[model samples]
Target chain A: MIGVELRKLFRRPRTWATIAVLNALPVLVAVLLQLTDLAPRPGEGPPFLSAVLTNGALFPLAALAIVLPLFLPIAVAVVAGDAVAGEAQAGTLRYLLVRPAGRTRLLVAKLLAVVAFVLVTVLVVAAVGYVVGATLFEAQPTGGTSVSGTSLSQEELAGRSLLAIGYVTVSMLGVAAFGLFFSTLTDSPLAAALGALAVLVTSSLLFTLDAASPIAPYLPTRYWLAFVDLFRDPVLWRDVVRGLALQGVYVGVLLAAAWANFTTKDVTS
Target chain B: MSAVIRTTGLVKRYGRLRAVDGIDLDVRAGDVYGFLGANGSGKTTTVRMLLGLVLPTAGEVELLGERMPRAGRRVLPRVGALVEGPAHHGHLSGRANLSLIDAAGPGGSGRTRRARIEEVLDQVGLGGIDRRPVRAYSLGMRQRLGLAAALLRRPELLVLDEPTNGLDPQGITEIRELLLELNRRGTTVFLSSHLLAEVEQLCTRVGVLDRGRLVLQDELVRLTAPTGATVVSTPEAGRVRAVLDGRVLGVDGDRVVVRGADPAEVNARLVAAGVPVSALALQRPTLEEVVLAAAGTSADRVEAPR
Candidate 1:
């Protein structure tokens, strides 16, 4: 069933089209910055944007920062939200259920497929950023300076970059979980996607308000950018750890809800 | 013969509305069972329950000797079905859709998947179909594609609901022949439709539903058996009625209904009396008449609250 789902997910042109369109923004940012040497001031405008001007190797992290705020999550939400609801809308859910795919097993396969989409999308964005950075800017063979004002070794930089990518992927999964949970609740893919986005938008909105600060740490998007701390001199594990735990909780809880609802609900469509 | 599909008092209720009232459905092996009902009479709901797509509110469903919605994994692979209408991903080709559905479950072996798809496509008269996506296919083509998906595994029993929905006259005839041929090779069929003519022509046994209730179920032959009368068509209908005076039930435009189950006896009597008989046959109820008599008015009709 997992194999079948992966085939269905990757075989469609829409999946790849989404990945391509997602990379376009980061690539566009790279081109604009390449044409004009002006970079955003330090500590402002996408976490690592100012740093990517000097160290082309840092562009991958810069690209992650650029899209992580909106594009990536929206893409994940749409795909994950469409998982069950899209099938229902297409009238294929009944056929799949009658195929006896086993409700629990189908849900797990769909979640994995969504995770795979996130992983691939993140990788492609990072890869395009790397190529764009290398071609447009000077190489920092000696290793780029960390945000903490320390010069990191080449291997150390690569290791930390990979960690940041993994972190971002996990955070996006938090969005996917919300979408998947909503997917099981409604038969409209648009509604499910919007529902998932609503959660993220609400979390993001609440994170900025002083009144919401009391409960800020518990928000799903709160630790989304915690990966930036990976570039610290000694590495700041504080919010990073919290973000991972928070996403884990969301994924677990939302997935459980999706399963409980899907396995028992009647497939009238 | 063993029963292929047996439901004992199967019931499904959506709140206060009993979509599928308590009803027993018995479909034996090698039977072309036609399930007849009006729109909103819960035919689709019952089909869903049988396949475990919709759970029964009360009672039970068993397919191939195993309890349903429970033993579905063990049993559904052997039962092919097309519920409501055909549904497929519009973006993909018919073949792609078939492979995906075939791969979704256990029993469809990946190695033989292509061959199975090809065979079923041929069986459903789409063997020469091109690589065009299903979105471009006409309604008839889509219905055939749906049938091809159902037949991919060569299931032992087929449960098709309104299988001929969008087909032209020729397409309908072709599908009827295909279904009959499949049944000839020992495949049991449970066909649900509101087309009484289709059911009358193909069914060995029939069940009728009216407003969520199973109003009638019996062998098609039994349901349409001779009504202890004979019909005679003649230009001299008046002379025949005069001869069979007391036995004449009714007369309508050169056709006379006489109180005799034996057509041969009626013919002999008419010939002996010098009343030329153009046609003489024992009266048997048509499936439409039988269904109309057994079931109530259309369930789609809404009445004002008393």
Candidate 2:
């Protein structure tokens, strides 16, 4: 049932448009970073482009962090946000619910669709960044030594890229879960989408503030960039674990709330 | 026949407003029961409670012989519904929408599922719209599609709220006849609507609600013929008055007699007396009048089950 929902999400024009536009953004950013004086000289350390790309897994990981608040979150929101509210607005929810299918099943299917959309959005960003960054910056990927005093083979680059995509994908699940959470609360898709984005943006801002807060670990957004640490020589699994734990908590709470609200909703509106 | 759906002391309160206020109901098996009320009259709210979408503040709902809010999962399978509006995935074609829904149930071979889809589409007069995207369908067509989806499971109990909404007269007639046929096949229907005449024509039993409370409930015939019309007519007004003076019937001009009696006898007597009666027509009270009268008179209000 959820796979069917995922297919519906992919077929939507807005979903494709969001992916296309976001994919082009990183390419443009990479080009701009290379033209500036801030970029590294031939022998200098990794520049801003390299900071994003050559940090091996950190390149796409950084790209995800940049896109999540403005691009990825909204994309997830559009998909998840429309779950119930969009159905109600389109005058199709009542028809769907009338089936022998339980409301809980419908809610789960919609949430899972949103999660799939989020993963797809992250992969699009990572793939686009890899192609554009590798072509424009010509920097050898960091970590292992270079062969022939240059960058590694194509297979090595592909392996590193896939790992980066994986990190970005898992990290964005929080955004998708939150989007689904907001979807159950509103009858308007636009409202649910924008409302969920607002929450993501606010939490990201609070998480990055330079305050000496003891509660940072509890903020789900704090782990948004934790994927960057995964590319280290000795992979720092602590932040990755913390990020996964934080995401699990968000998913658990949001999904539970959605189930409770939707199952009991009057929905006459 | 035993009631297939019953509600005792059902109350649903949203903040300070009581959407469904202590309404009791009994719908027997195979009944084409009409639920009548104006907008915001709590008809939809009551149905939602029965469907287990909204919890009742205080009540017991028994559907298909099991108590609701507790045995909802057990009872819901035998029941099907189209609560208020037509809801479907706009991106998917109509056939795909139906197929997706059918897949969620006990898995079946593709051929059987497609056949089931075709059956409902044909039943609801939507056989030609199987391939069109649901977004392209007009409101009436979408309503028919919604009905088709409800019938896909071959549910024993069909609960539809305003099933005729957005439908043209012809479409309404078609749905009404289809419902009648379904009832004949032993499928109980619980339909909600503000159209009283349609209810009068299609429903055997009805429950009239007003402002979140049930004002009347009974077999349609009982409400329509509470007391038949009584017409008394005579060519000479003075003679008619003299004959009916202090009689136990309503007197209007040259006519007088007990209400609900046939007018033929009154007209025959006038003609025999060389009175040359101009006209005598019986006026039967309608369901609208009964509903209106019931809504107005507190004495006629029936208490809901507790």
Clashes of each: 0, 10
What TM-scores do the predictions have?
A: 0.98, 0.86
- Predict model 1's lDDT versus the native: 0.94
Give the fraction of reference interface contacts each candidate recovers: 0.74, 0.44
Estimate the TM-score for candidate 2. 0.86
CAPRI accuracy category, model 1: high
Q: Tens digits of per-residue lDDT for model 2 on A100-211?
A: 4567888888877776777778777876765665565544544432312344454654565576567666666777777777778887988988887887777777776768
Per DockQ, the best of the predicted structures is: 1
RMSD of each: 1.2, 4.9
Any runs in candidate 1 off by more than 4 Å, and if so which? B272-274
Q: Which digits, one per residue and each the tens of the lDDT, describe model 1 over residues A130-183?
A: 999999988799998989999999999999999999999999999999999999
Cα error of candidate 1 at position A88, Å: 0.8
